[model samples]
Target: MDSKNKQQNDQKKSTKSNGNSKSQSNQTKSTSSTKKQKQARFGEEHEGKLLEFFVEEVKDIYFAEHEALKALKKMEKAATSKALKDSIVQHHGETEEQIKRLEQVFELLGEKPSKKKCEGILGIIKDGESVIEDTDDNTMVRDAAIIIASQKIEHYEITSYGSLAELARTLGKDDLAELLEVTLEEEKQTDVTLTILAEESINEDASNE
Candidate 1:
């Protein structure tokens, strides 16, 4: 009788252990499935208010870039330093290319490339114009002023592009993100170039004046 009771208890323990193992395995599978679903949530259809907002922001930047083109032309003409003028001209060309990229981004979204005036950029441009007005032309001080104004614009672009790129990724629009990131990098490089020009000679020359 003792031997039989011991065998029964051992069998019960084995069955309980097996049951726990199965339960744990099932739970793990459930957790994994949930994780996969979450990962694939933004796969294709990005129809939401977020997307609408993103599109509007893109349009804003488009208008801002157009305004920047005009501003760059003005700045280039106002600038006395050859280096500053050349940099502005180069960025002006890059701004054109950036607009083309934004057009492509609109195409990907099945939308036409449209402009929505960005008051923020408008204000910044106005400030830049003020800088030019306040400083004397054909002087290093004007060049320094131009550099400051240009950097402000670059910083704005950086913020816009960085935010847009992240939003694109969240929408699972990797291609759009790539395009925005490229422009973001360009803006950052432009800012750095301006800084280098300032530190190398523009600022010092202006101070002497």
Candidate 2:
């Protein structure tokens, strides 16, 4: 009878331990759920700030393209290849159109075109200047450098336009977003064209030197 009583006591102790383990497991799950909720809220807040940042970045891109036109004109002069020169000249006109689009975007926003120094574009243009001034103005060398410089500018503009489009959409400016998207597409195409030109002609000729 005493042994049976002890067996009942052991069974009760095991049952109690199992209940405590289940309770701890449930608590841990609840804590994890709370942490996930907090993280989701934080991500939403961060996304809002990122959209605002892109808007400001688009404004900076406006001025960056303007500065790019000036540098492009210099590049046109420095270019030794006829095709490269023509491409630069054509892009200068395109850049002007791009600026006009940006102004339209500003007007749409009930704002005026304003200047802000874009350190990124400034650095790119400065690098182009160094390439133009330091490199021997040989046909091959100039074309190679021009390819590198022009592609860099195109990539930057593409990124800026794409981001601006996303921001505009987030802000419910569908028309503005569409406009920026079109420009972004054009910039990407231009970059692709440059790549094709470089591959089909520029690099081959440059290498022959």
Candidate 3:
């Protein structure tokens, strides 16, 4: 009887040990799965932030381009030089293409093309408006003013596109980088054109006036 009782006690102990081992194993698996989920969430959050920043930069330029479109019309009207006015209209056509390129960039990134209120562009536009208002109508002074203002806008665009293109490259978006670089080159060209216009005749004419 003593031996039988001892055997029964051993059996009970074995069962208890198995139960504890299974419970511990389940707990470990649960903990590991929780850790994996947390890691995945963290990675997603980080990626989300980077994408957000890229999108915001795109929006800023989008807004600037639209502002420029409107300002270009006003500058064309304010310009006294026939040549300058024609250049302004030419730039208007370029602006249309630039906006479309930006929209393509948004599509490549799987995002909607959007814009934010660009205070910098707005300020430049307002500055141009004031210059027009302050200067006498149909005067070379206004032409000079329009040229200078347009150059400022072009410079801003060059810087913005350069940075954005670099960011796209860093983010491994080669296609986006290429598109932005094209726009950047255009902006640089426009800046140079404005400078030439100012140097060749507009500035000298203003000085004479």
Candidate 4:
């Protein structure tokens, strides 16, 4: 009888152990599933936020480029040196092209090309206009001022395009990134040209004036 009782107890313990093991395994699976769900939710939210910000920045730069076109025209008119005028004219044409490129980016995203009011670009443009107003016309000083103002604008474009390109890449939009990088290179080249103009002659001529 005692041997039979011992056998029954052993069987009960083995069954209980198996039940506990299964329970633990199920709990672990549930925990893992919950973690995965949370990660997925967070990823989706992050992607949504990033895309929204990217679109907004695109709109901001769009507005800025338009404003820049107008500002470049004014600066070109205010400039005295033929070199400076030619550079401005080239950049003005490039700006138009950049705008078209931005429109293409919008189309890629299946969105209309729209402008968002960018106060920063407007402020910079205002400062450029002020430079024109402060400097005298038909003088090297005016040309120098124009160069400085144009460089400022180029710097802004460089920053905007560089950032937009990186963001586009992050969003897995390689085509958009490629477009933005092209503009970014153009902006950098324009900056280099402006710097060369200043260092080679414009600054010296302005100083003498």
Candidate 5:
């Protein structure tokens, strides 16, 4: 009788332990689900001042990307080096993709895409245009000038994307931030490529002339 009672008691204790373990697991899952819901709510909430500022900055980048596309095309024509022209052509496509991503970001915010005048991009585009006009297109100096102009645009993009990504993350917009981060990495890579093209031959060739 005592042995049977002990067995029953042990089984009861084991079952209770299993029940508690399952309950805790469910509680943890519920907590995680709640956190995700809050994050979703954060996205759906109406824009306040920070979000307004965030959207304004996004518009700046959005406008810059469009302007950069035009500048790249003109720079591609201005480039004497086949390699540099090809690079600009490739980046022009990437900038197009970046523009689409920005439009998606606008969709995420429940807003139609709008532009804020980006004077910085405007200034850089003018500089690129001036370089082309001042240099003879067939010369090595023109290739060097194109590289300089392209890299300047790339650096501006890098700074803009980095800031936008940081801001997106701060506002709990991880999806948007990741998109900007992708562009930021591309800009950095393009700058590195431009530097390589210059250092390997273009700059030296230009200096010889």
Candidate 6:
């Protein structure tokens, strides 16, 4: 009888061990499935919130820079000072490069280069036009107009690029984040250059007039 009881206890222990093994296997499978699902959702983290806002914003940036290329030509032609004219031409070249960079970013995201109307940029350009028309100081007027227009543009880019960097980081796109950080720093540097030109050259000339 004691041996019979001992045999029953041994069988019970074996059954319990098998059950635990099955449970552990199921748990491991569940963990692996979860990891696979996360991998499948890789870029989904960038789908919502200001990312949609950023997409539209970047599209506007592309259009604005393209438009600025034409506007820069006009600004360059209208500029009286050789230094200011050279600056406008240089910026035109930079603008072209910036547009190309934006296209690269679009390609990275599997998108085509496209334009979106940017009312903010339109308004800024219109304001610059008004300033150019109203001021009779030809030597300083175009320079001032360029500062107004370019600074506004730089501010917009700074905002957009910063936002894009944040979005790229959130989406685990380290490469994109790095690219945007570089762009953002460039925009800031350009703005500083414009400020220096305005304060040291344009504004001083205007004051003398």
Indicate which candidate wins on TM-score. 4
Clashing pairs in 5: none
Native-vs-model 1 lDDT? Answer: 0.91
TM-score of candidate 2 against the unseen true structure: 0.74
lDDT of each: 0.91, 0.82, 0.87, 0.90, 0.85, 0.75
Better of 1 and 2 by TM-score: 1
The digit string of per-residue lDDT tens for model 2 on 38-71 reads 8669877977787557557767998899898998
> Higher-TM-score candidate among 4 and 6?
4
Error of 4 at 68 (Å): 0.3
Give lDDT tens digits, candidate 6, residues 1-209. 25698578656655655566777757756765686578557536535555666667668878888877777787777776777777777777777888888888787877788889988878877777677767665667657776787787678778878887888887667876887787788788888888888888887886676
What tens digits encode model 1's per-residue C-alpha lDDT throughout 13-122? 55655566778757755765685576457433444778999999999999999999999999999999999999999999999999999999999999999999889999
lDDT of 5 at 5: 87
Residue 101: error of model 6 in Å? 0.6
lDDT by residue (tens digit), candidate 5, 1-209:
25698578656655655566778757756765686588557655744667889999999988898888888887877788789888889899989998999999999989899888888889988997897789885899999888888888889999999998998997889999998898899899999999999999999999998
Counting only residues 3 or more apart in sequence or on different chains, how many pairs clash (N, Cα, C under 3 Å) in candidate 1? 0
In candidate 4, where is summed lDDT lowest over 10 consecutive residues?
A: 9-18
In angstroms, give how far residue 147 of model 5 lies from its true place.
Answer: 0.9
RMSD of each: 10.6, 12.1, 13.5, 11.5, 11.1, 11.3
Off by over 4 Å in 4: 1-20
Candidate ranking under lDDT, highest first, comes to 1, 4, 3, 5, 2, 6
Per-prediction TM-score to the true structure, in the order listed: 0.79, 0.74, 0.79, 0.87, 0.76, 0.73
> Which has the better TM-score: candidate 1, or candidate 5?
1
lDDT winner: 1
Tens-place lDDT digits, model 3, residues 1-209: 25698578656655555576788757755765686588679877976788789889999999999999999998987889899998999999999999999999999989898899988889988987887889898888889888888988898899999999998887788999999999999889888888999999999999888
Off by over 4 Å in 2: 1-55
Model 4, residue 129: what's the lDDT? 88
